[model samples]
Target: MEALLILGGAVVFLCAWVWLAVTSRRLPVGLFVVALALPMLTLLLRRKGYSRPARLLLLTGILISAAGVALLYREQPEQFDQLISGSWVTQPSDSALSGTLMQQPFVPNDVRWQGKHLIFAEKAGERIRRSLVVKFDRAEALLQGTAIDLLPGDTGPWPELVLQWYTGALEQPGLRRLDGGYSMSLALAAQGPGQTEMVVHLHLPSEFGTRLTGVVVIDGQPQWLGKSAAVPEPRPAPEPAPAPEPSRTWQEVSILALLDEPQMYVGQAVRLTTTSGKEFAGTLTAVTDDKRVVLALPQGANQVDFQFHPVDIQRLQARPRQ
Candidate 1:
C-alpha cells in the first residue's frame, strides 16, 4: 500500500511537470505546485519498504525537478512573478514609490530613490529590520547596509568596482553583522554616468524560505529583484601565522670565548662535554675574569656547584626554549 502511494505521488508530480511544459502558459503555477508536492512524495517513499533502487529513483526525480524550477526562475523571473498574486501583475514602473522595486514574493514595502542613492526597505518584523542602500560618486562607490559598509575607490567598470568592494569588505571588522547571518553577493549588471545597474544577491537560511534573492537596480533605482538563486558559498578564513623559528645556540665556540662573554650564557641551560668523554649538564652560575667558571648541577635532592677551568670545557651546547 505504501509503495502504491509513493508511485502514485511520483506519477502526479511528473504529470504536473508535463502539463506545465506542454501548455507553457501556466508554467510557474505548475512548477510551484510540483515543487511543493515533490518533497511530500519523497517523504512518503522513504517511509515505505520500497527497494533501494526504487527509492533512489524517486529521490533523483525530486532533485531534477527542483533544479529545473530554479533554472526557470533565474532565466525568466518576470514570468515567475505572474503566479505571486492573482491581482498583482508584473510590470515595470519608473517611480520607485509606485512600481515594484523587486519581483513578486520579495517585493519590498518601501523604496526611496534620491540623486545617486537608492534605498530598499522591507516590512519590519519583531526580530529583523531589513534595509540596504547604494550610493555612487564619480570617484567612489559606496554600499551602506545595516551592519557593514563597502567603500571602494573609484575604479572604472562596475564589475571591477564590485570585486574591489567585496575584497575590502572582508577585511572590515564585524562582517557577520552586515551579512545579518546570511550569505550575500553584489554584482554589476551594467554601469553608466548618473546611472548604475547592479544586483544584490542574498542566500538566506532555510527557515527564511527562499535561499536566493536577487535585487536588480538601475541608475540608483531598483528595476526588479527577487529571492531565486542559491547563495554563493563564503570563502574560507585565512591560515594562522607560522610558528616562530627555534633559537640556534648550539653553535661551537671556544672556551676562551665563553669566559670572555659569560653574560651571554648566564641563566641558560648548558651541557659541557669534556675531552675525557664525561658530560656535565647544568645552569651557568658565574664566570670569573681569571678564566674560572661555576656550574650548578642538579643532584638527587640538592643542587651541586662545581668549579672548573675554561680549558676543561671541551664542547658546549645551549638548550633551546621549551
Candidate 2:
C-alpha cells in the first residue's frame, strides 16, 4: 500500500512537471531529472529502511512540482495579455507595420514595411509620414458603443506619433481607419544620419472610462518621404471636358440592307458601333446568313477575327480603301 501511494504521488508530480514545462515553454532539466528519479529514489530508500526519508523526498517532489505549476498558472493571464497579433497598417496610408518585441524591458526593433526591411534616408532633413491599421474582434461593437476619439501624435522626429492586439491569428493586413470609423496614426519624421525609427501605440478606454487593453505597438516606415519642409498646396483640378454626342449615322444605316448584300461589303473596311457604346473598326471579312458579322481586326503583326451579331451593331458603315 505504501509503495502504491508513493508511485501514485510520483505520477502526479511528473504530470504537474510536464504541464509546467509546456506552459512556460521551458523545460527545467534538473527538475525533470529529479522528477523521473523520484520513484526509484523512494523505492531504494524504503528498501534500505529509510522510510521517513522516502516520505520526505516524495513530499518535497510533490511540493516543488505543485509550486512550479502554480507559478505558471498565476502568470498565464499576463502572458496572454503580452501577446501581440493582428493586422497593422502604416503611413501615407499604404504601408503595413511589422516588427519583433523583446521582453525583459520590452524593446521593439527590426521595424519593417509590409514584412520587408525598412529603408530610411541616410541623410537628415527628410520629412517622413506614416499610417497604421488596427483590427479588433469586437471592432464593430467597440466602434458602435464607444465615442472613438483618435488624436494622432508622434515622436523621434516631430514628437507626435503613437501606435496596438488580437486572437485567432489575423491573416491579412487591416484596412485604414476610414472617415470617423477609426482614426489612423499620422506623424512626421525628419530623418537623420543615425537610425530613424518610430513606434506607435494604441489605447482603448472602456465605457466606465477605464483603460481597455494593454498598449498595441505598430512599427513601420513612411509611404511618402520628402525633404521639403513646407508642403505645397495641391492645385485645383481642371474641369473635365463634356463628352461629345454619339454619332447619328447609326440611325440612318439599315441592318437588313447590309445582311441582304453581305458579299458587296465583304473585304471592305467597316466601322461598327454598338448600342452599348462600343465601336469596332476592321476589314469586313465575312457575313453569315445567320446574321453574324465577321471582321478581321488588325493586331500588331497579325489580324484577329472579331465576330458580332448585326443586332448588336448600332451602326455598320463600309469605307472605301484609303
Candidate 3:
C-alpha cells in the first residue's frame, strides 16, 4: 500500500513538472522533469522484468538527476531550504502562550505566557545540553516584574537573573554548577524599560539522556516543557580506568571455612604459594587445628605427605575441576 502511494505521488509530481516545463518553456525545469521521470520509468521497466535495459536506464537517470539536483540546490539555495525545512508555531490557549517558539529543527515542546511572565521549555536528557530560545511579546512589562527562573529538572529555585542590568549585562545571582549539568536561571526584569522585543537564551542541564521532565512556571500556573526538544552538545568520551591487581591475602575465617569443608576440598588439586617464595602443588589431605594444612604430593608410584603452616601461606587457589 505504501509503495503504491509513493508511486502514485511520484507520478503526480512528474506530471506537474512536465506541465510546468511545457508551459513555462524553461530549459532547467524540462531537464529536471526528465531527470525525475527517468528513475521512475526505469523502476517500472525493471518491475516488468526488463533487467538489462532497466539497469542501463537507472544508471543514466541517477547520474543525470544527481547532477541536476546538486546544481539546482546550489543555484537556488532558498528554494531547497524551503522544500527541506519547516517551522513550528505553538498553538495559543488560555493556559499556553501564543508565539513562534522556534523554526522546525529547533522547536520547543511547549510555551506559555501568563500576564507579564513568559515561560518556555524543551526536552533534555542526561549529559546532553540543548539550547532553547524564548521570545517575549511584551518585554517591557516582564522586565518590570520579578526575576526569570531557569530550573533544570526538579532541582531549582535558581535565580538566573537578578533585578539589575548594566549596559545589556545581566547580574546572575544563583548561577551554580550542578552534578549533571549547570544550574542557572534567567530574568528580564533587569532590562531597560521601553524595550519591546526580548529574547532569552537558555542551556538546560544534562541528565545522561534521560528526559528531564519539568515546567517553567510563570506568575503562578505551571507550564509543562521539555519533551525531546532540546539539542544538547556532544559530551566527551569517558576515559577507561585501569584494572586493579588481585589481592594475595586471605581472611582467617575464610581459611577456616575451607577446612570445615574437608569433604569438598580433600583429594582436590590445590596450589599454595607462601610469602617466602615457596610453592606447593598437590591434592589436599587434611587440615589440622594448629592452623596447618597437609597435602599428598605425587611422587612416582608413591605419595608423600607435606605439611605447612597456614600463616606462612600467602595465596591459595583451587585447580580446575577434574
Deviation in angstroms for 217 in model 3?
18
lDDT of 2: 0.39
Write one digit per residue (lDDT tens) for candidate 2, span 117-221: 222111111211222223332232222211122321211111111222111122322222222212122233334543223323222222111111111223433
TM-score of candidate 1 to 2 decimals: 0.23
Report the C-alpha displacement of residue 117, candidate 3, in angstroms.
8.5
Q: Give model 3 RMSD, 1 decimal.
A: 25.6
Cα lDDT tens digits, model 1, 211-275, are 22344444543333221334344333232353455563454556766777888777777777643
Query: On a 0 to 100 scale, what is the lDDT of residue 125 in model 1?
Result: 26
Query: What TM-score do all the candidates reach, one by one?
Result: 0.23, 0.25, 0.22
lDDT per residue (tens digit) for residues 228-277 in model 3: 22434433323224234333222122455666675666766677664334
Task: Give me the candidate number with maximum TM-score.
Answer: 2
lDDT of each: 0.43, 0.39, 0.39
Worst 10 residues of 1 by lDDT: 160-169
